[model samples]
Target: MDNEDKKQDIKDDENKEQNIEKEIDNNKISDEDKKNTEKDNIDSSKNTSSKSSLETKERDWFFEPKKDGSPSTVPSDVENVIKNHSTYFLGDTSEKVIYLTFDEGYENGYTGKILDVLKANNIKAAFFVVTPYIKTNKDLIKRMVDEGHLVCNHSVHHPSMAQVALKSKEKFKEEFTGVEEIFKEVTGKEMPKFFRPPMGKYSELSLAYTKELGYKTIFWSFAYNDWNVDKQPDPESAKKRIVDKAHNGAIYLLHAVSKTNTEILDSVIKELKAKGFRFASLEELK
Candidate 1:
């Protein structure tokens, strides 16, 4: 009777050990499955973030009422739409900084004089140009680089900027990369990662598109109808308009195509300086 009881007791101990081993193996498998599920979730989040970056909504950009001695404003709808993306309609309000920008869609023989005026005043500005402008005006683009001025991206073509919202990720990236390639090819220098929408037209999606490409989407606080090469405005009156509308954090957009701008730029600079407003580069906005 004692021997049989001893054998039964041994059998029970072995069964208990086997059950404990099975539980440990099951826990190991469960832990591995949990880690793999967590990894999949993280990868999924990353993919979603990248996809959302390309799928952006659109908003039309419009400058608010700008008057003499008054700071320009941005529309709230536009502002609300683009606030998350890297864009600026105005700079630091506490500083009396004037941002002078020029659009160069094509050469009109006025850029050189404008450069001269800017050089004479010792103020650095941002000049935005399309690909054709860069290809044709390599010397001026080089001059801008050598003189510490920023040559910004205006796009590969002077197309309507509203279409950027409809672009696929590849097409959206192409707009910026296309210009950067040509700019680097033509001037042998890296282009400044700043952009202005063509024809002063843009959508919130376009702003986000540019921001995703490592660019700062710049909009003017003040701009006039200065792009006309033929029917240019009166130089005296134009100068007066530019200066009188000056305010803190002013981003003034002029066109290099305008003969009046080339002629009146010096006076504009002098008058703006006289009014206690200092010209600054776009970088200061950051």
Candidate 2:
């Protein structure tokens, strides 16, 4: 009777050990499955992020010109990028307003007259200056600041910022900080946190970096081929083109080097003012 009881008890203990081993194996399998699932999810997320990064390629700012005095039409994707990066090309369309911006790559002997016209009109505009321009034209830059105009960064070497940004974020930042350092040295004031990509060339990455650097990227709604100094457009025709293209929330990109722009700026301002379009500073942009 004692031997049989001992054998039965031994059998029961072995069964219990087998059951415990099974449970342990099941738990190991469960843990492995969970880890595998998590790895898959992480890999999937990384793939999606990589695809999104690939999609954010370089893009040039463009708009459809309309002579009906309506707001110009920009591509929906372009508009989305601008908004996503907190950038601006157009202002509040509900109000008739014009934001005048001049790109000064270099002094072409027209900036002073342009300044005189601006002073006479009591209109404050934004001047996007390059590092070279700021270095060479300190007085003009100072005048811009003194006159309540916004002196903004155009870049260090005025290359396509998208290219710079894609290469390295530090380099992209240097493009802005370079101008900022010089301008601060010249004007003794902090440069405005506004930027216009050189030649209106930019990309989503560039815009993102710009926003990270605490700058608002500015594009233009209306621009003509007035940058070529060798062949400036006729002032009368240029003025007609400018006034005809005047729409609500228009951001006009004029070359400060353009003699035609300097010649016709006063008339264009008066005409636009008469049409109930108030000139506004970028700071007033909604």
Candidate 3:
């Protein structure tokens, strides 16, 4: 062939290769399947539906599915709507600091020791309590307040906020109001505008309602199976897990009822401090 004819033939070969690549890319899935896949993707991404759209209304809570040594994160669905919406999972990323919070559901006599360790360390923490805990441990609650610690509303009956807050505004209102009244009655000070949903259970609407009620919703960056008073974690291993996961702007959820935590709190604090991690109150984020 002549020079121009050869060039045209090469260009035709390139076009044929490109078409073959397109065909290979479409292998296994027909064009019909591809169209259906695109439609399914779009449908799955629609976040407009409210909680009422579902049949089985289980309160959805976010837990990090993997632990590959980065700071624990929330689901994109949770993060998308609540971004800049006053819901806090961790503190600012400027320093190696941790916020300590305890869910006090009827203290099991170890909260006093936990408080003693915190006092000795001179680190303040946020204590989330229910109304029953209010009447049950008035002195401890006051001490948490008087010691300059934060008292956060954990709801009245300790119900999952996802089940209560958005579902019934009155029930949600009564839940927080009851706890606030008891806290005010005991501590003689208004409770701080901080809320941690019970069992780390929450929904977008629950978060919005809590924010509307003048509170910042709190979730933890790091927590383990420490809620059980009966099945306490081994102190050293628990300490290791906590210290290993230490990162800037971490929030730790520890149950006050765990004797393991009570035994390890002082060491955990010291070890984290040794690793250059300082503790801060949730008020810092608020």
Candidate 4:
């Protein structure tokens, strides 16, 4: 009887050890699942943030700054057309010269090639840069400045001046001095001479304000639909449109992001040269 009781107690101890082992295995599986779920949540959040950034940038191309310096009063239909008018093609009056100005808002992947084309041809052009572009792309901007290219202000937020009321001197200061301050902050140089409105949309009041701030309003007369990245013009067509439309004192406004511009730039320069046209920087013109 004593031997049987001891055997029974040993059997119970073995069973208890087995149960504890099973519980530990289950706990480990639960922990692994929790870790995986947390990792998936983090990945989902990163994707959402990326999508949000792309959306914000796409919408920002046309919106104007509000009274509080945030995006507001964005006219969806006319804003793009208004902003592009700064690249006017005024035909030659005193001499056969065309002014070339490129707007560098952000890299769309074609600025370096454009610069290479200009540099290879030994031609000079004006570059209009915003604050962020100047800061982040400082190496490129400095190269432009060092290579004798003119760097001008295109406004801090690229805000349209036509939207401003300009009811007071402070309003005028905001329109002109605001951009100047940004250029000064980035390059450590004062820019008080020339400015182009965010989108060619400007009121007479805005022009007067600019002049009061010792700035000349730059407007373009010739531009093509090259800002649309997906619907790009063919290289041949871009070359033709530009070569045919160019006139004396024409300021051609081309976005640096256009692939057609990069592909056809060399030919355009050569053809213009063959046509007895000379290229001039914005500063070189009267």
Candidate 5:
């Protein structure tokens, strides 16, 4: 071949080598980009998982009490969570109605009198009773049912329902079904599909589990420190606290274990009735 032709051939070989090298570099860069993209996707997935967990964490039901008879305020997100689960804390805000609910963890020798007051007032209330309460106070449970009141499942062992639900869905199911089985045995009827989490502690996951069981989780709009029998609020103060906090759709949570509640329940009902607030059953909640 001529010397010029040989030189041209050499130049062509060098250009091919350069192009091959550039192609290898581009493949390496593409591999590195693929790895980086995978890592970014993993990080985004972890963030989404963390956010989902936070959204379902346990929450204590709370409301800001208003003394001027305005509907109490709950945190918007908390309210949304309750509402999304078909749960209820307040009823129709347009009507002056109150839903009276009693949490009976155990017998404190006051439920009978409270029932008497309710019977006298023609107020049908809901009584959330734990398994122990149902087992030991079968007569009271019977009385609650016979008097046209609702005997709701408050859980079997009264553990944090949210924690129970997170640990095992079957266990959570048992918490409710256990109470229901015994209630049916005692009453010869199927228990009402109502529930109240132990100590007002719940989560979106727990509430969802409850809803799946065909139950409406009942929360309260008005509650005082009446659960502690030892540190019961003064009867007069409790009556005023209850009466003054009376809103259009108040769900008053009273502990049946409180002697003070038994003492003041009748008067509170009368005072609220005087103020044109009618007692409503949970079945009647709008």
Candidate 6:
């Protein structure tokens, strides 16, 4: 072979070696991509399993599978308990804060408007709701959650929490858990850690049982005789009573069904604001 022929043969050998190296690099890249895909699938599976476990826990503790029934009207003895002794539910804080709560044993057509006023004033509150309210007013409940308000359990049948005799601890638990179940079923969210005993009637036994079930019984410091549809207090007087009682760490109880309450709420907010009190959710006080 001549010199030119020998040089051409050397060039062909170098080009073959370069092609082999390129093929090997591409194979390695393909193997790495396969490994990455497998790892991603594993991560996705683990995430799905973890989410399923969380949902199961939430469902077991907080929601019923189906709606039970309508909530009964507020009982008279329960009203008396509410009228006589609701002072201890007020938290002992010195800040210029007032906690707002609305009872939903029955809807008398004012809850949405009440929620509107609260939204307009940039305030959040706690709504202690029964089963019907949970099942029927899902939109309002959704709004409450979306708007950063708290929804707590009031009881299944709207029985007074305090009026339960010492012997009926199991009954107390049932009512409390029943409402919690409805809230979970409707909203797929856990009920608030706070609770408002129906009619503000909680006995020592009732309170202990609720605590065991993981709840804090919230009571209001300021409330008017607003539940009476027959003798609803005038709006201005109701506003005056609420404004005068506004103070730091005060919990105000107002019925969502009160027309007088709806009319006076704006002025009440203004007066409370003017008095240097700020409205807050129950969680903030905690």
Count backbone overlaps in model 6. Answer: 3
> Which residue pairs does candidate 6 place in steric collision?
161-201, 162-201, 162-202
Q: How well does model 5 score by local distance difference test?
A: 0.90
State which candidate, 1 or 6, has the greater TM-score.
1
List of clashing residue pairs for candidate 1: 59-204
- How does candidate 2 fare on TM-score? 0.88
Error of 5 at 187 (Å): 0.3
Off by over 4 Å in 4: 1-92, 165-168
**TM-score result, candidate 4:** 0.65
TM-score of each: 0.80, 0.88, 0.77, 0.65, 0.81, 0.66
Assess the local accuracy of residue 80 in candidate 2 as a C-alpha lDDT between 0 and 100: 69
User: What lDDT would candidate 6 get against the real structure?
Assistant: 0.72
lDDT of 2 by residue, 77-99 (tens): 77766777868888888989999
Please report, in order, the local distance difference test score of every candidate based on alpha carbons: 0.82, 0.90, 0.83, 0.69, 0.90, 0.72
Tell me the tens digit of each residue's lDDT in model 4 across 58-143.
11123232332221233544344333323222434467788888887887878788889898988999887777787778678767
Instruction: Encode model 3's per-residue lDDT on 143-259: one tens digit a residue.
Output: 888888999999888888777854578887888899999888998889999988888777666777777799998888888988887788888899899888887788888899898
As a whole number from 0 to 100, the lDDT of residue 59 in candidate 3 is: 50
Q: Cα lDDT of model 3 overall?
A: 0.83
TM-score, predicted candidate 3 vs. hidden true structure: 0.77
Clash count list over all predictions? 1, 0, 0, 14, 0, 3
> Is 2 or 6 the stronger prediction by TM-score?
2
Top candidate on TM-score is: 2
Show pairs that collide, candidate 2: none
Structural RMSD, model 6: 16.9
Model 6 scores a TM of 0.66
